[model samples]
Target: MPFASRRPRSYASPRALPSARARARHGRNGRSPVTGPDLPLAHTRLDAFEATVQATADYLQDLWPDELAALRIEVLPMPDQPPGVSGVARWRVIPQHRLVVLYRIPIERMSRLHREDDWHRRLMVESCVFRAVGELIGKDPWDLAPDRFRHW
Candidate 1:
């Protein structure tokens, strides 16, 4: 039968939720055919991520004033990953220089509140964000590393 072998339709990547257009589309209503109140909230959390990203960028800029042009932030969506109760907001912390700092974080408060069934989604999303940034920057997020410049 023609229907027997039909493939399921694919969806837009979950990673797109953090984009500016997506954020504007979701707005305060958190209403979308593809996403619900929960997913919109995840999108909202991106505000926190963006703030942190800016802060980190500012800090780096101050320390490396000479190389500030070399340092910048780039965000990319990791859509190939799965989706559900949890999602990861990952991006690249690339610098023109060889050395750059990277940070990975999880909304632990959100995870604790998620239903048991969604634990995997939370972990998977968080892991993807962490790993994606690590891969892009050629370094992992950690506090143990020394700053590229201490003169500032």
Candidate 2:
């Protein structure tokens, strides 16, 4: 009679819940639960800048594969050495190592843009990449992507 009078138990486990720190370490942390890491909406300015550099480099590489095949491109927050006679270098091209190091802060912050927008920012990044690659191969930046600019 006592067993029949008692209410049925709920399905969830009675174990103690995980600590906040443990949950945070194992869970999404701060990202939205519904979204994945590949979401384009999550891109930051740095991401966009790096992407622009990569796209420009890839395009140049496709055009001049022989020249760029062994070349390596890198992005740094800032240069390690002091500014040269000209000024803070946006990029450094070392042909001996086949490496091009781009100073992201100087390139992103120092450039004078007529219109402060995403398109102009991207163009600025691309120009830096093109110039760096041009220096690497002793070619002019305009010559790097000649056909792209040609309009009939």
Candidate 3:
């Protein structure tokens, strides 16, 4: 008969299949299928360096509000031109502009850390920030945060 066939037709239709865009969009759920909330987001070296610099700057600012009130902190991949006289400058301070620019590449890569670890790397970044701020304000790096290292 005309209705009879070798194989039976499937109930599901082609339209039911998810589109490529829908699949890419995670099928209405915003989160990626591969990454869940339990898994933390990737943190790159640059991100860690910037975070350390910012935290150090904030601490220094709290200690010397009046001095750093008008100052601006910035992070750049590298210096635009070679420093006038230096063995790979880690940072530059411009008192006229009240700006401190930290060179991420030189500061992170050039330093010789006796023990290479996350803590040491963070300490290195903090050192650069403190030195840069000290240079801007005509003060020694150690003097910037005196009580911090003092033990009672």
In order, the Cα lDDT scores of the candidates are 0.42, 0.80, 0.80
Clashing pairs in 2: none
Clashes, model 3: 0
Q: What would the per-residue lDDT of candidate 1 be over residues 31-110, giving only the tens digit for each residue?
A: 36566555653444344444444555555445445544454443332323455736653333344432223233433333
Q: By TM-score, how accurate is candidate 2?
A: 0.73
Look at candidate 3 and tell me the lDDT of residue 52: 86
**Best-fitting candidate, measured by TM-score?**
3
Candidate 3 global TM-score: 0.75
* lDDT per residue (tens digit) for residues 1-152 in model 3: 01111145465756665666866575564335365767976787877886787788889888999988887887878878755855777888899988888899999899999999999889888888888999999999999999887898
Clashes of 2: 0
Of 1 and 3, the candidate ranking higher by TM-score:
3
lDDT of 2 by residue, 1-152 (tens): 01011244475859786667856876656434355656645667777776787778778888998988887888888888755666788998899988888998999999999999999998889888888889999999999888877899
| Model 1: per-residue Cα lDDT at residue 138 | 56
Candidate 1 TM-score, true structure as reference? 0.30
Which regions of candidate 2 are displaced past 4 Å? Answer: 1-41, 83-86
How badly does each model clash, as a count of residue pairs?
A: 0, 0, 0
